[model samples]
Target: MNNPVMEQSTPRNVSRRGLITGTGSLLGSAALGGRALAATPRHGRAAAPGAAPRDASIADGAQVPALVIGSGYGGCVAALRLAEAGVDVQLVEMGMAWDTPGADGEIFANTTDPDQRSYWLRTRTKQPISNFLGFPIDRDIARYTGILDAEDFSGITVYQGRGVGGGSLVNGGMAVTPRRENFGAILPTVNSAEMYGTYYPRANTALGVAAIDPDWFETTECYQYARVGRRHAQRSGFPFVFVPDVYDWAYMKQEAAGAVPKSALAGEILYGNNHGKKSLQKTYLPRIRATGKVTVSPLHKVTTVRPASGGGYTVTLEQLDTGGATTATKEVTADRVFFAAGSVGTSKLLVALRASGALPRLNEEIGKGWGDNGNVMCGRANHLWDPTGSLQSSIPTAGIDNWAAGGAFAEVAPLPTGIETFASFYLSITRNPHRAEFSWNSGAGRVELNWQTAWKRESIDMAKSIFDKINAKEGTIYRTDLFGTYKIWGDHLTYHPLGGAVLGKATDNYGRLHGHPGLYVIDGALIPGNTSVNPFVTITALAERNIEKIIATDL
Candidate 1:
């Protein structure tokens, strides 16, 4: 999706052009008469124009034209498009604003030195790489609302971002569009031509997706690890490809030149990127605020949704404190509601709502077709001669593409330990066919996913197809100290959780709930698990297509 013209343009130029030309009809009408609002304050700190009010909160008996649950990619898209259509929207998020800096003068904590700003409501941090150098690296932390949520189930741990921007707040910013050939498998019901020709490019342009300068990447000290990874993959006869990211490339260049404060160069992913990365807070949320038809309330958790006595849906929400305590309960009515609380959150809510007699007409597919996006991690112990650098960039630039041949695309991830580990780390997304289901457990009164850890075996094998060959070619072995003692595969967790309330089965072609006229599922829950690569770009594009149709037809 990288245009040569866009690659050569600076971020400032790109932003200006995108606002004027890329959004086109989507923002053109709204930009003319929309009242600009302040951006959603980060952790209560005031932000610039194009943000929601700092004290924005839904009143107990509020009534809105549209209510969007969760402020992630899909929710943001739905909110923006609906607002552009001149509808008033109230967006409720379960996480903090993250606009204010902490005592350490940073809005987000570093990955290596985490504090209360790391894990969500956990007394101890749950690092994806739980150990390093044969020792557990997990540490105790205050129980506060943090960025990443390492939600543990019976067999696997799902790491999710908890905040207004959703997964965009804590991801590696690898904005990838699936191959056109593979799009059929990704979303079989959708028209690939429209997606590729219009929505994908639209999403890419609005997302500020850009490729790194190839010449600079080849020589930057920060990307030495990626270069080494490329060498190993190419030497082993695997295809190495550069992936586009939402990060500000010009700012990254300045970071490399020591002209600005380092973010990607400093160990700053996993938790969140303080600078450079163009998360939803910088992209979609600002646009939503610019529409001036939306009010976003952070730290508000939706608990129940039922048909109102008069009409529409009556939604119950619990306002939460930083320590995960509910301080107030409120009710609001909306003519229409969009479920955009991610895959797991959306599925869990829908399942519970269906089973709890709130929305009994929901189909049986409410809790079905859930799958981890074939996420698996591993590290290779390189020879001492090829020591991975200590000063590594947190942003991943390249991946070993074995998807067509081996059903896996391995991101040459960074250790970013700030020390020479002589290890090459990777996060592989593979074609694992196993799909799990989320069911409501009445006795436990919670949503449960029957995702066994054994399901990851296919993913591990697929990833090994690339790494094993590289290891054989380079005379190396799998690193055993990263995940746990003697463990070679980090298969117990997934960063990309998809499906559950799938597109065709759970909703109509445009995300309208099958039984409910005004309810929709627009988040990752619509996808059936795998996307053949990173899933965010596809998610955004799909939401874009779905909302456009809904605005034209429904609204």
Candidate 2:
């Protein structure tokens, strides 16, 4: 455990020296267990060797037991676990380090003067909305080709994060352990005692997840919002549950020190919590790095992975910055690698690699069975209610778990993005279609997601039922008809996307691509089907479970 003094003294700033070495394993392997060892700082920086005159432009091979791609939830979890197990693990993140590159690592913050504009985008565009969301992709189309039109962009709910922490760095930070049943659904093969009792606790603690502060529950915007629904449920009681969140209690304490009086409560979390929120970058990865065996290399984009001569993997990478000049291309070798670059990232990379004949032995299920978990936005009303000026700081502190009763499950959370307060409920109900297809378009360099519409009536019927109940109640001045009014009958925008590379009776439950032994797929791509709820926690827990199995077999 890290002492408070050490935690406090650790600088939040990013060091340009790039990689730091320390002595401690990720997994709890006794083989390398010892006092944490810190490597002496190398004062002079070395320009990437690939940039110089080299026959083949690849980074000199540095051997490690495990190499994790993408520092998102799954990759971070895998890196931490393997490092603790005495494995020499290296983590490569495509995104740049946070804070310096501004929000999404797209621009620099200090480039614009304080008198003019603090960020580059503010000066570059006429409207804030247009510059931020409107620009389509010219360069780096793989990640940033604005898919949504102006009107649809406003209506279209999309989420993407690029930084040391990945999506967890900029998400709403609401953390809820999946209902034990939902957690069990994916792990039909794994036993309950091991799955729920052990790994669940480990993940929760690692995440520093907790129920919303009881005081906040009473005073926060959530209470006022919940009151609208409670009045309706009073007539015919339907239990609503308060879900847990990943908001950082300590960061909240620190912000309280400066005391800024804003209408919002917990700093508009959806647009990136500038104050205090429990993002993965701020939470787990730091702790994982403290173990010393793991080194995180940011601004590193992995393009290809090939089976090496010694029965390991040789990963081809590109250094985004070397002496202010980007390198040609670099490669590194690792005994094992975990691909946890979220659903879209993993699927695209795998599909492209297979198309390139880099890893042809990858399972036939490379890009198949992709579903977005039928998402709907519905709201309730309380008579005589006027919450116009009330602070809608916290995002999604309350929810109804009634979708399970109607073949699907719906989880509702507050949407406080200054978009619309009337939308008291942003609900996503699960839709289990028999099959869906995923295909990658190389010309466009994007993955196309298509889902067969089944259980359509059930989906609308469920949304209408929830909406009607809320409106019927008194003292509520608003109504929700996101489905009927919005014409979002087809595919609704969802924050949670699952199933591009799916798990099944065919592939290993742990997501080791069917025929490929050492290559693994441990992100959202492995969910057997729609999780019927937010699948981030499920993804993290499943990764933890999978890493445990990997250790049992490999270590």
Most accurate candidate by lDDT: 1
Global lDDT scores for all candidate models: 0.85, 0.53
The runs of at least 3 residues in candidate 1 whose Cα sits more than 4 Å from the true structure, single-residue gaps closed, are: 1-44, 48-52
Decoy 2 TM-score against native: 0.73
Off by over 4 Å in 2: 1-61, 101-158, 220-222, 233-236, 249-266, 321-327, 379-389, 407-412, 415-423, 442-446, 452-458, 473-491
lDDT of 1 at 215: 95
Candidate 2 lDDT, 261-290, residue by residue in tens: 221253344334444566675567666767
Residues 189-287, candidate 1, lDDT per residue (tens digit)? 999999999999999998999999999998888889999999999998889999999999999999989999999988789989888899998888888
Provide the global lDDT of candidate 1 against the true structure: 0.85
Q: What is the lDDT of candidate 2?
A: 0.53
Clashing pairs for predicted structure model 1, backbone only: 38-51, 39-51, 42-98, 42-99, 42-100, 43-98, 43-99
lDDT of candidate 1 at residue 60, scale 0 to 100: 94
The prediction achieving the highest TM-score against the true structure is: 1
